[model samples]
Target: MKIVEIGTGYTQIPAKIGAATEIVIENLLNGLNNNGIEHTLIDISYSNQVKNSDKFELSLTHYVNVPNWLNKIKDNGIIHIIRRIWYSIGVGLLLRKLYRNKLQTETYIHFHNQFNFFFAYLIAGRRLRKGKIRTIYTVHSPDWSNSKKIPKKLFFEKIAILKADVIISLTNIIKDRIKESVKINSCKIIVINNGVDLNKYHPIIQGDKQKQIINIGSVCKRKNQLETIVNIKEFLLKENYKFVFAGKIIDHKYFNEIVSYIHSQSLSEHVKYIGEVKPGSELNKLYNKSMLYISHSKQEALSLVVLECMAANTPVVLSENFETFVDFDSKIRNAVKIISNHNLINEINNLCNNVSYHKQYALKQMEVIQEFYTWDNIAKLMIKKLAQFKQTL
Candidate 1:
């Protein structure tokens, strides 16, 4: 069998897309032990210099013409070229022609974002009904499917995705959300937890570890970095623990609120914003130097940062209510400390009181991840399902 993955959105180049694409290809690479199977990745980038593995290939779309192209009007400026007439007419025609050319091949696109999913559906609708090829649509989030303002888009989105043979859900919560919106039942949606390379993120030398705790991810309202900073504020006054807010700042208003709280709490020296750092090197160092990794986000779907910390064998303190810890309830009860208020310092103080014992929970969680989250296992499960699909077809 051959597989094709596509991600066309601009944000598809960011961390989340990077993670999904890495898992897809890495798993396929792991699956290469079977000499009979073939795989290909198609996107806007692989049009040239495609992969050479006879069984695996990368197919790229035509390059975007910058400046003059209407589709690229927002390449830098603040306009939706896709809405413009001239560029849309020209570039849109070229795109339709390109998809028409490629429909001859057997491919299943793992569209990393919603926009591409809808586009793929429209561009390939005729071929899809004729069974010219297969398509696998993974819902990363319910952005387009569940938004109030996107009702028109939602109809096509539902039609396109429900048409798929399979839908991979990163968590059961997301699976339930999809089930509510689409008529497809559980069998059509499979739960495949994302994986981490346990070997790479292993905990490093326990440094003298002055007071440092690291929180990864962009600073945003959804991220709830404010709560973490509040926790740091509380920790600073009670204990000497240092807090490092890594990653770039976003959501300026919320970020400013956090800064104000930090100032009011007099934690300027204790809590440091290290900006963005290299994930492989600098970020790992931050994780290694810290005693615990904390996240205060209210919304999550199997957090990658938490899993990464578990792989590193560092304790994680995530702000989760009763519902958020559905999967790891035991660890949630044992490892997580419920933040009752914005008294983040008090929360961290309460948590740090027994970091070592809580460390066991992270280790146990890591064990669970190693058992179930590895792409090798995920690929095996996916391949088995696909084989069954092929037999049925």
Candidate 2:
């Protein structure tokens, strides 16, 4: 079967920086290519730097150009809505021409963004019937899964769900939440976890690791980096541990709060916030050299970094709030430490003080990554599920 994968249109595919959704799309396409699956990626035009980069293969990619003036507006405001609508219309028109006389059942159109899917449905949904071309929507971030109120985004997400033939959720918890929130049939949703590139992120032999802790994500209130520092204040002050935070500063105010807290507590020497780091080699190196990787994110569908760390044979500690997000089984539970805000310091200490225990957790994490979280394995699972889904159609 042929497949057409659509990106968020806000970021280029084969992302060089910190757009997790775009990165996931890039890896999934690579997985498909490795399996010899016929597919094409439809994404926004790349920047001059990305165009010059030798890292990505653009022969199979179709670039959609949005107006340059739109970039000047603030993100997630009027510009966000306008660009999504523009991209969706472009995608719909392009698909119409591509599939003019082609057999619809032989093709699949997969989408990863709510706004794009919602608007594209308006243009393409009526023309493509249920038994014809299949539309699959993968919910990358179910931000409204736990919300009590119906925000504007949730409304669009609900519409997208109704428009899609099938929905792919990153975790069982998220699948259940989507069912309850949207009142859709559970059979329509498939659970597939995000994947890591094992070839790029693998364990390295080292004599001894220094006392370093690393957290990678956008510096924002949602990621809760400041709270992570607050929880480990004593360690930063008394111990020789260095806390390294890396990501684009999406929220300058929240970053300032982290800086002020670090300064107020005399932690300039112990803590550092290096801005966004490129993915692949740079990220994998950071994961390998650090003694431990930690995240205090308030919400996530499934963190790609968590899997990357595991593939690098690094022990991971997470906030207890992610218990639902990761949806770890008993086997996977032994691979990572999850602690509440109250027990954060104690758990970190337990992992840091015992070298054997740290090694054990790292080994277990690598085992889990090998068994289930590789990109090739995930791509095969998606193909299997799609075959089954076709039988029903």
Candidate 3:
């Protein structure tokens, strides 16, 4: 069987920076390559980066070069919608050409974004169905999980879910939410957690760690970096604790709010925003050197960073809303501290005070990551599940 992995056109594949979905696509492709699985990756073109580096098998990757102007358009705008539609059409045309006279049942087109899935359906739904070409749509984040009413974008997402032959949910909780909200066969939805590159983010032995706590992701309100700071303000003021924030500044206003609050409160020495750090050695090193990794995200389907931190042997502390781990093994769930507003400070203190426990916790986290959350494991699981799914069709 042939598999076609479709990348969201927003970022180039083998992502050089912090596009989590794009990175996942890259790692999955790598996993496929390692398993000797023959597959094709369709992605946007990157001028500076070689489309097929030594890291990938040359024959397995393809690039769709959109117009320069379209590529430059900022995300979430009307023009961006046009770009996605245009790209989706291009994808359809390419697929048509690739399988011109071949049996579509032998091919699978996998998607990672809602826009790509919905627009591709509009462009080639009839051909896909008549030809019996299986399509898999992975719900990266259920942003509308708590919405009172479906927004226009989410309406399209729901349609995409219904139209897809299979839907991959990052967590069981997300799969349950999709089943509750959308009228689709429960068997078509499967839970496949996001994974980390064990080779890239393995544990690093170190002496006593510094009093540094790290948070990685875009600097935005939804990530709740500012709130995390506020919640730990007493520690920042009275102790030697240092809070370091990294990742692109996605929300200027929110970043300004964090900066202003820090400066006004004379916490500049205790807080730092180091901007985006490139993945691989730099990110893995950052994870290793830190005393703790904390995520205060208000919503997430599954956090790649959290998994990466665990792989790097860093103790993780998560806020209550980061519920992706709810269905995880009890030992795995117990490995990381999940806190609320009431227990946030206390949990942090407890983790910090107990050095032996912290070391054990980090080891447990790494064990879970190696056993179930490696990209290779996730890729193999996906292929096994997809093979079973294809038999039903």
lDDT scores of the candidates, listed in order: 0.56, 0.80, 0.80
User: Which one wins by lDDT: 1 or 2?
Assistant: 2
Clash-forming residue pairs, model 2: none
Q: Candidate 2 lDDT, tens digit per residue, 1-393?
A: 867789888767677677899888888888888777888888775233244124567326766667766655677667777888788777777666666664744677889988778776777665554345778899887575455444665777788777788899988877877877788887778888889988889987766776889999988988889878888879867778999999988788989889999899899989999888899888888888888888888888788888899999789999887875658767567778888878888877877888888888899999998998889888889888988887876
Off by over 4 Å in 2: 46-55, 71-76
Candidate 2: worst-modelled 10 consecutive residues by lDDT: 46-55
Clashing pairs in 3: none
Candidate 1 wrong stretches, greater than 4 Å: 11-37, 46-106, 142-159, 325-359, 388-393
Number of clashing pairs, model 1?
8
lDDT, residue 248, candidate 1: 55
Candidate 1 yields a Cα-based lDDT of 0.56
Model 1 TM-score on a 0 to 1 scale:
0.74
